[model samples]
Target: MQINQTQSDGLKQAFSVTLPFADLEQKRQARLVELGRTIRLPGFRPGKVPMSLLQKRYGSAVMAEVADESVNEATRQLLSERGLRPAMQPKVDLVSAGEDKDLEFTLELEVLPEIEVPNLGEITLTRLKAEPGDEAITQGLDNLLKSRRKEIEVTEERPAAQGDAVVVDFVGRIDGVAFEGGTAQDVPVELGGAGFIPGFAEGIDGISVGETRTIKVTFPAEYGSAELAGKDAEFEITAKGLKQFETPVADDALATELGFEDLEDLRKFIKDRLQRELDSEARQNIKRQLLDALADRISFAVPPSLSESEFTQIWNRLEEEKKAGRLDDADKDKDEDTLKAEYRAIADRRVRLGLLLAEIGQKNGITVSNEELNRAIFQHSMMYGARQQEALDMFRKNPQAAEFLRGPIFEEKVVDYVLELAKVEDKPVTAEELAAAVAADAEG
Candidate 1:
């Protein structure tokens, strides 16, 4: 066996491996001998197959099997002996393979780049902190109370207005022809809610009980119904009743109605929930900042193959979004080449950051435990609802599917490990300011 490095480039290499035919024949003969002991043939006793007969019958198959084993073994040894970690599966091209000729193949692959993680202790990050304000708490309580609101018939004779729920019966017609699902009876619509066709709810305003009006509306171009999309329709609506939200006062009774011990308990729960949300957001923001800073500091060549794979995934998703008409506004105007360039850069950054995080985790001996992975898988399975057991079964059966969950868990653990070591200073800000910062980061 011999290995020659034919090409050496940054994060990529090509190797020529040669294995003598004698080695291949030796392995094939050994395997065939082992098989002969368990052989069963018609008109012949078990373990009694002649060597000549066996070789004639299965010689080619055994040689092929042996050739595959030789290639895999040679590649494994080549990578291990040279300390080369491939970023992706190596491509092997068989140059020559015959009964008498030496088995020769070329192996080409992109190797994992050498990554130098930034010093965790020296990394500085600002952790944005926000506490729920009294106004926010009051508003949250108001919303909670409103969610429990009920409607009652309007006793005063007044026109329907915004925030009022009106019950109406209506028939819709397009081109003087009625369509399916265009009519309903005693439907309750909140004025100004915009839940129905454009101008339908607003047109209901200024109408009194028992008054009938014909409202015209044009469906949106992207409306779900293909037949009615961008088409004009008229609804003959009769206002049957008007109702307003009657919210309960925030009191002990209100809390009891929501299964809480008291109003203060409800407030505490809301505050805690809000605080958790703020804390989660702050941690996420800080993580992103840390990753961006880390990326900026590192100057290493990323494997083009890895970047290409990542770019392919991004481009595929973008194409899917375009097909679904959910493409981002900023991406919609860009030509394919421009979008590819932008996404390729993004892919490069992601690969570099991923490599850095992996290095950090490796250097610190950080790992995602089986229990943690199980928890992650269980959480992911919950998204399947009634088919959660089926999801679990799939994950258990498929190692690759389980790996999808492991990647994020490992990355998050690495992030948390860095955060623990990094110098993160808390900076208090208003909830609105924090939200603005997060939004800005997302847009940027």
Candidate 2:
């Protein structure tokens, strides 16, 4: 057996491997012997077949199997001896293989670049700290009250105004033909609320009981229903009843109605919930800043294979978004070349950062525990609600599917380890200010 370096480029290496026919014949003979032990013939007992007959019948087939095994073994030996970590699977090209000839193949692979882990202490980051303000709590409470608000019937005949709920029978038609899910009776619609088409709710404003009108609306270009998207339709509406939401009073009565003990208790819950949200936002902002800082501090060539793979995934998603008419406004004006260039840079950065974090985690012995993985699986399954058990079973049965959860947990563990060593200064800001900072970070 012999190995020769064929090519060397940045993070890419190619090699030529040759195995002597003697080694190939030895492996083939061993495989034949193993098969002979279980062999059965019409006139011969098991393990009694002649060597020449076995060789004559299965020689070529066994040699082919031996050739495959030799390629894999040679590739592994090459990587192991060279101390090379491939970014992706090594490509093997069988150059030569035949009877009584030396086996030869070329191995091409992009190796993982050597990453230098930066000093976490030297990397400084400002972690935005935001606490929910009184105003925010008040707003949250108001939202909760609105969510729980009840409607009261208006006995007297009156026109439905904005914020008023109206009961109506309606049939929506596109091209003079009523569509599926287009007709309904006595549906309560809030005149100024969302959920209806762009102009459907507003068109109901000032509609009086017993009045009938045709409201025209165009579905959004990105509407969920592809058949109805961006199409104009007319709804024939007949107003039947008028109703108004009861004015909400944030008192003990309201709290009790919400299944809380009192107004103070409700306020405490809101405050706690708001604080949790703010904490989450802060954590995300800090992590993003940390990642950005690390990216700026480190510079290394990423394996082209990894970068290209990442770019392909990003480009595919961008294409899907463009097709769905949901492309980002900022990206809408960019040409194909410009978009590709920009996203390719993003892909390169992502790959580089991923490699850096992995190196750091490896050096620091950071790992995700089985318990943490199980907890993550449980949390994921909970998203399925009633099918949580089924989700759990699927994840348990599919190791590959569950393995997807490992990356995030490992990355988070690495980030947390870095955060512990890094100099993160807490900068207190309002929730709005923190949000603005995060948005600015994202845009930048």
Candidate 3:
């Protein structure tokens, strides 16, 4: 066997390999011998079958198998010898081969790029620190009380107020014909709540019980149903009843009703939960900031294959957002050229960061153990609820699925390890402030 290797680009390499006829003949002879040891065919006892007959019948099949294995083996050996780590699978092509000559093939692949992870000790980042605060907790408690609130029958025979809940039957039509989900009977509507279109809920206000009226509203331009989007519709409604919220007081009674012992205990539990939520958000914010900082410090030719993949992922997401009108106004402000340039830069950053993390992990011998993989599989399984065992079985049965699980786990571990080396400082801030910081980072 002969091997020749050369680089095509920063991360791409080409390998040409040739295997001698002697090796092919040896494999063919071995295959025939193995077949001779097996059971009888209809014409003769299998062990008594001649080697010439075995070669005549299975020679082509065996040769193809041997050729494939030979290419795969050579590719593996080349990677081992050169220490080249591919981002994805290596592509192999049969360069030249004949019935009884040298078997030849070429391998084309984008190897993982070499990266110098910089300034681990001097890199600065700040993790946002926050508690939900008194205002937020009070709002949360008020929400719970509101959830327990019921619609009490209105005593006064007067028009409905803005905050009043109305029980009504309504039939809405566009072009004088009803649409799906546009008709309902005895539905409860809280006036001024996030119900229906912009003016739909407000139109229900000031209607007294037993009144019948037509409420006209227009669907927004960005509505989900394309046919009905921006269309005007009139609803024929019969106001059956009017009611007001009867909220439960925050006391021991409310706690017992909520399956808790006392209001104080409930508040304490809620406060602790809220604190953890804020801290989780803070940690996530810091993680993104650190990634962005690391991206800024690095510049190298990302493996073109990975850059294309990253670009596709980001661009696909952007397309979805654009179609849904969910892209932020700031994003809309930029022209397509500008947006592409900015996002391309982002794709490059992500590819570079991925390369950096992988190189660092490899250099430090960071790897996911079998125990870690099993645990990850178990946790991922639990995400599917009662089918967890079935999902776990799937992971255990499929090597690729299990390997996919390792990538994220390893990535997170590497991020944590890098954070330890970086000069990350705690920055106490309000929820709004932290949100602003993230928003600003996103805008840039």
Candidate 4:
């Protein structure tokens, strides 16, 4: 057996591995002997099959297995001996496959770049802090009440207007042909709510109960359904009932209704919720700033394959958003080449940041604990409500999904570690100002 370096370049190495035919034959014989002890033939008992007969029955299959094992072992030995880590799976190509000749293959792979985590003490960050203001608390209370608001049918005979809710039966047809998902009965639509098609809610503005009207709207050119894109449709709508929302005042009674002891309790809950949201946003902003700072300070060549993989993921998401007509305003005016170029840069930055964070975490012995993982998974499962158990089961059952959670958890832990070491000065800012700062950071 021999391993020879064929080529060496930045982060990339190529090698030629050769195993003499005799060695391969020996390995094959050893594997066959290992399998023979348990072998059972039609006319022979277990461990009684003749070598010649076994060779005739399974020689080719055993040789294939031996070849794979040999290649894998050679590759593992090469990587281990060099103290190198591949950025991705190494590519192997068979150079010679004849049984009578030496077995040879070419191994090519990119190694991870060496990274030096910057001095934590040298990094200074300003962490934003905001308390939910009185107005925000009042607004939150109002929103909470509105979420529980009941609707009562209107007694007055009046035309449906903005903020008025109405139940209607409607059928939409494009070019005189009904389309799928174009009809609904007793569907509640709020006039001028902008929940339906562009002109749908406006068309209902003057409608009264028992009135019938035809509303026309054109599907956007970038609508999710290609078949309906840019097509004009007429909806024949019949108003069935009209109602108005009745929100209760945030008083003790309302608090009791919400299972809270008093209005003060509800206020405290709202304040706490708002504080959590603010803190989360602040943490996110700080993390983003830290990432940007690290990117500016660190310089290393990321594996092209890793960058390409990251770019593919970003591109896939962009394409999905574009298909759904939810492409961001920033991307709307950019040509394909421009968008690709910009996103590629983003991908490269992500790779660099990810690699740096991973290195820091490894050096500091940071890891995601099982308890933390379980807590994170539980929090994630909460998003599914009634199917939370199923969501939890999915993460527990799939290692990859668990790793997704683990990665973020590990990264956050490392970030927290870095924060503890760095000088993070809390700068108080109004909620508006903090929000604007975050927005500006996002834009830049």
Top TM-score model: 2
List, residue by residue over 155-226, the lDDT tens digit for candidate 3: 899999887888999999998999998899988888877756888778878999999989889988778766
Q: Model 4: per-residue lDDT, tens digit, 1-444?
A: 798999889999999999888998998898888788998779988898889988898888999888888899989998999988999999999999766888899999999999988888888899999999999999999888778889999989999987789899999999899999999999999976656768888888889999999989998876777678789999999999999988788899988988999999999999999999999889989998888888989989999999999999999999988877778778999999999999999999999999999999998899889999889999999999999999999997896887788998899998999888888999999999889988888888
Candidate 4 clashes: the total is 0
Better of 1 and 4 by TM-score: 4
Model 1 pairs in collision: none
Q: Determine the C-alpha RMSD for candidate 1 after optimal superposition of all C-alphas.
A: 3.6
- Cα-based TM-score, every candidate: 0.86, 0.87, 0.86, 0.87
- Per-residue error (Å), model 4, residue 415: 1.5
Q: Per-residue alpha-carbon lDDT of model 2 for 1-444, expressed as tens digits?
A: 798998998888999999999999999999999999998988998998988999999999999999998899888988998899999999999999999999999999999988878878998888888888889899999888788788898998778888899999999999999999999999999977878889998888999999999989999977766678899999999999999997689999988988899999999999999999988888888989898899898889988889999999999999988777777778989999999999999999999999999999898898888999999999999999999999999998998998999999999999999999999888889999988877887777
* Model 1 per-residue lDDT at 378: 96
Candidates sorted on lDDT, descending: 2, 4, 1, 3
Of the two candidates 2 and 4, the one with more favorable lDDT, higher being better, is: 2
Model 1, range 77-130, lDDT digits (tens) per residue?
Answer: 999989999999999999999878899999999999888776778889999999
lDDT: worst 10-residue window of model 1: 221-230
Residue 98: error of model 4 in Å? 4.3
**RMSD vs true structure, all candidates:** 3.6, 3.4, 3.3, 3.4
Give the range where candidate 4 is weakest over 10 consecutive residues by summed lDDT.
Answer: 191-200
| Whole-model Cα lDDT of every candidate shown, in order | 0.89, 0.91, 0.84, 0.90
Worst 10 residues of 3 by lDDT: 435-444
